[model samples]
Target: MKRKHPELYEILVKTYQQDISESFKVDFKALMGKLKERVGRNSPCPCASGKKFKKCCLRK
Candidate 1:
């Protein structure tokens, strides 16, 4: 929810869109999965670093 962290989520969502692209026009679950696998790594706080949710910040 960018409403909470407008600045951070704004950048994050932007980065997410750049990486996802138009091909991500699939289901919500699948899209979310890809997003986590892509930008949810380095982001330890929100774990949205373009990496797999399991292997992302979720681990550490």
Candidate 2:
């Protein structure tokens, strides 16, 4: 999988790490806004595509 979308994955993973590491900051509005722009939105699907959260593998 490293051969596919390496740069995007790298940046996204790093951003997520940063996000999780800041869990106790008492404020997440700003951080969440930025993450939303970068990662898009997430919604549940009943089709059971069994993919990662942001992948939308269940969209089909």
Per-residue lDDT, model 2, residue 28, is 31
Best by TM-score: 2
Count of backbone clashes for each model?
Answer: 15, 0
Error of 1 at 19 (Å): 4.7
Q: How big is the positional error of residue 13 in model 2, measured in Å on the Cα after superposition?
A: 0.8
Number of colliding residue pairs in model 1: 15
Task: Give every collision pair in model 2.
Answer: none
Candidate no. 2 TM-score: 0.28
For model 1, the stretches where C-alpha displacement exceeds 4 angstroms are 19-60
TM-score per candidate, in order? 0.27, 0.28
Taken over the whole model, the C-alpha lDDT of each candidate is 0.55, 0.49
For residue 1, give model 1's deviation from the true position in Å.
3.2
Q: Which candidate is the best by lDDT?
A: 1
List, residue by residue over 1-60, the lDDT tens digit for candidate 2. Answer: 557989988988888777564565433344334443343236432223454435643232
